[model samples]
Target: MADEIKNTENQELDWDSPISKDAGEFEIPPIGEYTFTVANLEKTMSKSGNKMADLTISLDVNGQAYVRHDYLVLTSNMAWKLASFFECIGLKEKGQELTHMPWDKVPGARGRCKIIHEDYNGRPTVRIDRYLPLTGSAPAQATAATAPANDMPFEV
Candidate 1:
């Protein structure tokens, strides 16, 4: 025997009451590096039917909550972001490939990320500039010790 869920009546919302507009307003934090934790990872399909990983990073600045969304497409061209994400979380090395890596373990990972504010269509939006591994982590040590001799220009 199984228990059945009971349907309840829907309550009406009071639209005529005065609402505080300031309660919903939030100011974007300054563009700089900040510590963030991976709050959630959502795997979904893109519009073109390609696999996509949506990362939700939560940041605490002066006791305020801020969130940034990063989308990683599992494609050759866009895979670097995924790699960077792993490196940021101290999970992968530079120039290393982990095709069979377990992505289910990404939540709760902590790192620092550079954030930039950009104006999109007259609205201010926060964008993740780059991700950096936390100090004393393996990936951070590797990045510091084995930095490329020549500064190569690349975009992520």
Candidate 2:
């Protein structure tokens, strides 16, 4: 009986079977400017115990779906990025002081952002170049900011 049970178990496992035979590779979108909406935002701690805000922005390219995430470290110098992002969506103006705004109010903000295709650890990854203001007419593609050379000391 034990031998029969072991045979049944072996038959249930198919080492040669594929989980998804029809699965195809996902194509990365070309680098360019695209309209994006702040789909979600969350506050978390960085590896060094620093407070950071993660923003998940959604991109719709010719009906194709894509997502770009950005992190804002809550430091005096790094705070400008967060302010610039708010300004891009018309929430704040240039040189305007940021008030006590709740992080939960970040979602639903719409703006234009530049997307760049980059190689991360030999893998293709999409990154947000920069955020542009939402004007009556689409503004020119903003310049891509230089990313840090080293990997961030935290995981999403």
The candidate scoring highest on TM-score is 1
- Compared with the true structure, what per-residue lDDT tens digits does model 2 show for residues 18-85? 57547444566789988876777889987878898878777867765566678888888777777778
Off by over 4 Å in 2: 1-23, 137-156
C-alpha RMSD (angstroms) for model 1? 16.8
lDDT of predicted model 2: 0.69
Global fold similarity of model 1 (TM-score): 0.69
The local distance difference test score of each candidate is 0.70, 0.69
Candidate 1, 1-156: lDDT as tens digits: 011111234456697867554633346778888887777889998888899988887775655557777778888887677778888887877777876656866777777889988777677778888887546754222122455757557654
TM-score of each: 0.69, 0.68
